[model samples]
Target: MNCRTSLSSWQALTTSSERLKKQHLKTLFDSDSGRFDKFSRHIPGVLFDFSKQLIDDSTFEQLVSLAKESDLAAWRDKMFAGEKINFTEDRAVLHVALRNRANTPILVDGTNVTEQVQSELEKMKGFSERVRSGEWQGYTGKSVKDVVAIGVGGSNLGPQMVTEALSAYADNTLNVHYVSNVDGVQLAQVLKKVEAETTLFVISSKTFTTSETMNNARSSVNWFLESAQDKSAIAKHFVAVSTNLEKTREFGIADENVFTMWDWVGGRFSLWSAIGLPIALYLGYDKFVEVLEGAFEVDEHFKTAEFEQNVPLIMALLSVWNTSFLGHTSQAILPYDQALHMLPAYLQQGEMESNGKHVTFDGQTVPYTTVPIIWGMTGINGQHAFYQCLHQGNVIVPADFIASVEPQVALGKHHDVLLSNFLAQTEAMMAGVNEEQVRNDLQSKGKSEEEINELVAHKIHKGNRPTTSIVLDKVDAKAVGRLIAMYEHKIFCQGIILSVCSFDQWGVELGKGLANNIEAELTEENVAYEHDSSTAGLIAYYKQKRNK
Candidate 1:
């Protein structure tokens, strides 16, 4: 693979900061009456309205051309066909196959991976049914009443986010808990809630050797054994989603209890794979299937839909327009529903970890930015937090406003208030308060001329901030699945547009490797290791204080 370093026209447009500064989203909308029809896309129960963004038809056309120049279609096909598109690891990026509802045959090596996916899904269904129906019992002959999922990164975030999003749909037969943080506080908190005898642990690690995951797994095992009273009982209570059967056996999980994860699946995209065991355990197997089916629907749309009509492609192009053409440095994922509170964090890892690269596929430095710093909280909470900056900040920040028409928890007028805020924020962002409006409002309040001038300056909002509103009919298992897959595909498209590999994450490895060495040093009290000046000083200070 040769390094590609040429800037796309979209990149060229954004290179001129002065040009971007002069363009306003409000002007873009005002100048075009069909802007909403041109920019918005709908598929199934989801509506993505990007008309409030700063881009016009010509800009969008240029983005489509950029996608063509990047050969996005070819890359998309390569991924679906199970080709070795993940160049860094020499693996096929085939998480799409995890939800292959068409049951299409996909091959990795000579093996039909679709068959393996189906088999694993069947295993998950059977296990989920037994556990949810009280047919699966622990060594103590008690039906499992709680689940503790132990994984890090993609393993943890995807399932945890989905389970939380679909919490209203949960049968409540068993309580589902997730432990991802390496901090002992996370594990200790979970241990205090569930009885170890009736708790089942789902350990998810592709290699079964992720340092944080394994450390947490070890702590969880110890916590379980404290109640079970026998190390042998670990086999009955602990299950694994990993291909490393040897490591799982060594860790005391029975062979039958060990599920499989494939190299074709990337961690962030593995929720559709066996990593979704926690989701199924929480919402029953049928709803879990609904999630997969929903994702498959998006998969079909992404694979078959044209560039102009494609929801994911439009989203990807709009992001490029915002970050590369409009000079926006960060993108916000603002979900109105409380159940989807983790979405921003989940997408932060999904988008940033995937496409936050400086280099293209062939090791050449990219001429433009790849991924924006994606961050946000739930919508109502954000209004009280950093929304002031979003409304009147010096820089333009593109935001995605997600809300459901129907609330999951209909607490009287709470949902209406939430929805009103959601609708009003986007409207305010698009149509900011002009100096005249501010002055008039001040005058109407009987302010003096000088006082009105002072207040107007602070009240005048440059309301051309770009935002996309994603309104879902509801947030069920299927809706959550479609929503997540929409972003996943959008991330993929953004990577393709930026000429970077979306599937590989070598960036996360450096810290994990260093942490292992640091952990060894801490445990052994080996203070002789060379380190950065800041780190050395900290370790020295800690060791001296401990010795005192």
Candidate 2:
């Protein structure tokens, strides 16, 4: 289907792609001595270096021109202005307003969202401080020392990722745990460790009725009741990050403990909202606000920076050029720092679940490829696992290599080794070893000609795989927030360029709706819905084998 917006960028980028096909990273760097300086830029807490990417000055200009043609600036403004950018859902994509540190008046349906945001922030701060100061008591007159966050998808991933990333900064008294899986093993493990007297459960479902979350919540409620043996204890032990007050009240949460979430904030993008209650409770409320401050700084940068210099816009343009123009179907996110181990999974949902759509804005099937598959692990671990394929594989995979300049905790040259590997991998990816170099090295080692000939192909790496290197000062709360927002804006800009509604996740809903129907059949004597032979056979066999 044809895009409703202008296709001028697509046409011009396609032409530019052909001309830049043979240009490699080595050539680009050699041609311009200031390649790194020209391509790299900074936000408040982070440095983004894209010199390793195969983008030259002429092609870079063309890519920037494409972003302008797609009206990325206007689309970005619409999102920040609370316009209904999520067309299919008819909701304004205003995750940005969740962290409006500037106290800017953003109106949604004639009501200012900042007022509600401020109210919620104050509420979160008070609640956290009360718990930390031993004012908010649990069932057995105990202060909270453990927090169990229960929810699935965005609710679970975002908070869990952030807390884990900032674990270095967390205080000693609080131990945060996350239970999102429907499988009882996860919750059981968490429950076995924490006592009802000291544990506070943060039930975080937007509707307060999500299947996995509610099931887990109910089980936890029953478990809490076992210890207290009184219904009133539930109020002291449970708080919620949900919008449905009636459901939360019914489940025994006090009204004051029910934090707010708005419809405009998508779950995947909800961390900047009160959905980050676990983060506040664990790291203290002030640190939580620092997270928002970091993200807001990037929001200002994306909103005001030119396409040529903007961090998010440059990221999106390079991604579009790699995937849509250069035929790469996947990108790797390799963080050198272990604190960011969850980043790949977090971004997998943030990007793929947003721009993975293949539908145009006018409700027609998209003819061209949209979002690429995003996957990776920590850089050092990946060096041992999948660096083989990345070095000498058939498919061209663009990669982002991330690290911090300063280690959070330095001990025994560990950070030095990690940073060295991080730098070497990108350099090796750009300028892969040739057969002659390998052969010379082998001969210098006194290897026979036969041995040299046999190992040459495996040792030769046809270099020029593109990579982006990003370094932060450190992985503090603000830095983590900045990194997350940078990618979020990149996703938005990518959607604008591709003419797809990045905010609405119809693809995820279709799967959930189908799962609901199949869930009903799981309790039936015989399956009712039509299915392929394999599915029907598997279900029938499971039913027959179960003794229940």
Error of 2 at 32 (Å): 2.3
The lDDT leader among the candidates is 2
Reference-based lDDT, residue 246, model 2: 96
Residue-pair clashes per candidate: 0, 0
User: Model 1 over residues 43-98: C-alpha lDDT tens digits?
Assistant: 99899898887766666776787788778899999999999998889999998999
Local lDDT at 38 for model 2: 88
lDDT of each: 0.88, 0.90
Candidate 2 positional error at 124, Å: 0.6
Tell me each candidate's TM-score. Answer: 0.96, 0.97
Which window of 10 residues has the lowest lDDT sum in candidate 1?
A: 1-10
Clashing pairs in 1: none
Q: Tell me the lDDT of model 2 at 260.
A: 91
lDDT of 2 by residue, 1-548 (tens): 44723466577778778877877778777788898888899877788999888877778888888888777889888999999989788899999998999999999899999999999889999988998788989877878889999999999899999999999998876899999999999999999999999999999999997889999999999999999999989999999999999999999898988999999999999998888999998998988999999999999999898788899999998998898888899999999999999999999999999999877888788766789999999999999999989999988899999999899889999999999999999999998998889999999999999999999998999889999999999999999999999999999999988888898888888888877777788876555899899988987787778746
